[model samples]
Target: MKNLKALLAVPAAFGAVLAVSGNAVAAESLVEENLVESVAVESVAVEAADTVEAADVMVAEPIQLAQVTSVSELSDVRASDWAFTALQRLVEEYGCLEGYPDRTFRGNRAMTRYEFAAGLNACLDVVIQLIGGGDLTDVRRLQEEFAAELATIRGRTDLLEADVAELEANQFSTTTKLRGQVDAHLVVPFGEADGEVPLLDDDGNQATDPDGTPLTTRDTLEEADATFEYRARLNFDTSFTGEDRLRLRLQASDSASSLVNAGGLASQSGRRNGFEDNIGLDDVYYSFPIGNRISGIIAANSIVTDDFVTSTIVPYDGPAVADVSGPVFYDQFAGGNFGAGVNFAFTDNLVLDLGYSSEASNVNTDDGGIFEEYSYIAQLNFLTDGLFNAAVTYIDGESDELDTPDYTIAGLLNLDFGRVEVGGHYAYSPSDDGDQDSYGLGVTVPDLFGAGNQLGLYGTILPDDEDEPLVVEAYYQLGLNEYFSITPAVIYADNDSGDDSENIYGALRATFNF
Candidate 1:
C-alpha cells in the first residue's frame, strides 16, 4: 500500500499541462520502459500485498478536479495560441483539469517529470471511467494507443515530484519580466547619394551671405562605402496595478544616418537608420487608465512627435525608409521633445489626442528654459470599418525668428484595398520667413512576390522657398526569416533642395531583429 501511495502521488504532481505540451509522451515512454521491470517486481509482491493494508495506497487529500468552461479561459492558453488544438481536446473530451485556487490555470508554469506523469494519470483515469460508461467515442482506442505512455507516465513520478518540491522552495519573483530587442542594419548607398546643401544653423540664424550667395553648405550626403549600424533597446515594464504601466527604456547605438544620400529631406536620424554612441535612458514614461475609454502618457526623456498624435497617415514607417521609402509629407512633424499627453476614445473608432513637449527643458536660465523650445500639438483621428482612416493635426512650436512662433496644419489619410494600402499626408507651414506646403502619396502592396514580401512606391513634393522639389521613390521589402529582412530601394529626385540638383539613389538595407 505504501508503494502504491508513492506511485499515485507521483502522477498527481505531473498533471494536465504537460499533456498539451507533448512532454508527457516522452515521460510516459521512459516510465513504460521501467514499468516492464517494476510490474514484474509488483506481481511477485502481489501475494504479500494481499496481507498489506489498502490504507497505505490511498491519497491523504482528495484530488480537486477543476470546472473549466473553455481552454481560452486559462491564462496560459488561448484559442489563438499555437497549442490551442491539443489543449482543446484535452479539456473537452478528457474532462481532466485542475486549476489554482483563483480559478486561473497557469499552464505556462514549468513542471517536473513527476508532475507530468501525475497529470497524465489523472486524464487516463477519467478516460477509463468514460469508456466504462460507454459514451467515449474514441477514448478506449486512444487509451490503448497510448498504453505504454500511460505506464510510463505512472512510472517515475517520484523523482519528478521530489525535484519540483526542492525547486519551489527556491523560486524567485512573483512579479516583473524582462524583454529586449536588438536590431542590426546594413545600409548601402549608391548613385548620387552624397552632396552638400544649405540650411539654417542650430540657433535659427541663417548661415548664409546677406546677399543670398551662401554663408555655409551642409554636406547632406557622405561619399563612402556601405555603412553598418545597430541599435539595442532594453525595456523594463513594471506594473503595480495591472491597468497601469511604468516603462523604462534603455538604449545604445553606434550608427550614422545617410539622410541626404538616401534622398531624405531633413537631417534627422528619425528618417535615417542609425543611432548615436553610448548607452542612455531613452524614455521614462507612465501610463494609467483614466477611465474605460481614456488613457494617458507622461514621458520625461526623448519626447517624440507621434506621442500625442492620434493616427498616422503613412503605412510602412520602419527602418531603412529614411531615404526614399518613408512618409515624406510627415517630414515637418515628429521627434525631439519632452512631454505629457493623452488619448481619448470618444467611440469605438474615433480618438482625440493632445500633448505638449519641450526640447530644452533641462536648460534653465532667464532664457526661458522649459518654455523656450516647446511645442503643443492636438489631433483628431477617425476610422471606418477597417477600410479607411484619417487624422487631422495642429502643431504649434517656437520659431527661430526670436519673437515669432511657427505652426503647421496637416491632414493624413489611409485606405485599405485588399492586399494593398494607400496613404498620404499634406502639411501647410505658416511662417513669415517661408510659408510652405508639403504633400506625399504612397502605396503598399503586401505579399507582392511571396509571403511577407512588400513593395512600396511613393511620390513627395517638399516646399523650398523658390523651388518645390519632387521626389519619387520605390522599394521592396523581402523577409528572409522571422528575424531578418532585406530591403532594396531606389530614389529619384528632381531639383534637390531647390538647387536643380537631379540625382538618383539606390540603397540596400538589411535588418536583423533579435
Candidate 2:
C-alpha cells in the first residue's frame, strides 16, 4: 500500500467550544484569527498551554508542501487557499512536515490509515477545538493498535480515519478533482470552384473552380479538410480553496473540410474529390488563479491580450480568421514554453497586465534536406472603466526557410455601454514580407429572447483594401447550463481576384467540471 503519510495532510476543519474567560469561543474561529497570526510572527514559539498534551491518541511528523510546477501554478495554489494556508502555517511552525531532500512534496499521492489518523489529531490538537464533544475512547483505541508507529504521529492510521470523518461532515472547503475532456478537429480548403478566384495558398497560386453544377445542395458551403484534430484537458478543485484548476492542454485540428449538401445532387458527388489536410494546434494552456487582484500563467498558447478580445475578424488581431483556428495556433507555440505576469488593480474600474514568452521551433524534410531555429513573443496591456482595453504585441525570430515572417504589431479594444459590449482590433507587418494588414469588430449582450440565457452577436472584417483580400466572420454562443453550450457561426470572403465565397458552421457541446 502507498504510505498513507500523504493522505493524512488533507484539510479537516472541526470546531469545539474552548471555554475562554468563562465564555464559549468557537475553536475554528479562534484558530483562524489567533493561531495563524501567532505563527506568522518571526520566530516560531510553542506556548506550553497551547501545545498538544500526550494522550492515548498519537501525533505525527509533518509533511512539507510541494513546490509549484511553474510561476502560474504557484499563484493559483495561493489564491482561494484559506484553510490550506492555515494548515501550512501549522505544519511549518510546528516542524511537523518533512519534505524530501529533492524538494518535491507529492501533494497528490494517496495515504494509508495510520498516516491519516495522526495528521487529523495534530490538526485538532493545534486548533485546540476537538476537546469538548466527541467521545475520545474510539480515538484512543485506534491509536494504541498502531502505537508502535503512531508513538510520534509520523503517519498513523487512527488519525487518518478521524480526518476523513471530519471532512465528510463538510467542516471545510476543498474541491476534489474528477474528470477531463479531449477534443480533435481538422479543417482545410484548396480548389476554388471559380476560375477567376485567387487560390488560398502560400504561393499565391491562381485558383480554379471547374465548371461543375452550381452546388445548390445546401444553404452552407464546406471547405476541403487536410488533417485530423485532437485535444485533452483535466479539471478539478478543492472546496477549501473555492477555486477550480485545469492542466495539460493538447490539441491538433485538421486543415480542410468537405461539402455538405442540402439537395439531391449532393449524393452524386459524395465520392468526388478530397485533398490532403495539414494539421495545427489550438490554444493549449492551463489556468488556475482565483482571487481578483492576482494571477499568472506559463504556456505555449499564452496570449495576454487574446484573453480579453471579442473577435478574430479584425485585421491586426494577428492572423486572418481563415488562417488562424484553435488547433493551428496551439501547435505554433508548443506546450513547453513559459511565461509570467500579474494583474494589478489601479482602482475599481482600472487595471494593468505585463507578460513575456519564449518561442519554439522544429524541422521536417520534404523529399530531402535539414534545418533548425527558435522564436519569442512579448506583450503589454492596460484597461479602465470597463470601456477601453488596449494591448501591443510583437513576434520576433522566425526562420527564413520555414517561410515564417519575423515581426508583426497587434492591438485589441473593447467598449461597453449600457447593455451592449463592442470590440475592435488592428494588426500590421512592418516589412515587405508576409501577411500585411488586418482589422475586425463585434458586440454582445444578455437575455435577447427574455429567457435566463445570454445572447452574443459578433462580426469581424479583415485586411486593408490594398494587399490581402477581405474576409468577414460572425458567431453567437448560447449557454444552456453550467456545462453545456451551442455556437452558431458564419464567414464570407470577397477577394481582389473576383471569386466570392461563404461558409456556415455550428457546434453543440456538453461540458462538466471534474
RMSD (Å) per prediction:
17.7, 22.4
Off by over 4 Å in 1: 1-145, 151-177, 183-185, 193-195, 198-224, 255-257, 261-276, 323-337, 362-367, 401-405, 449-451, 495-500
Please provide, for model 1 over 281-327, each residue's C-alpha lDDT reduced to its tens digit, 9 standing for 90 to 100: 77788878898999998877777656566567577555335433444
State residue 497's C-alpha deviation in candidate 2, in Å. 2.9
Q: 392-444 in candidate 2: lDDT tens per residue?
A: 55545334323234455677666767466666666664444445565556565
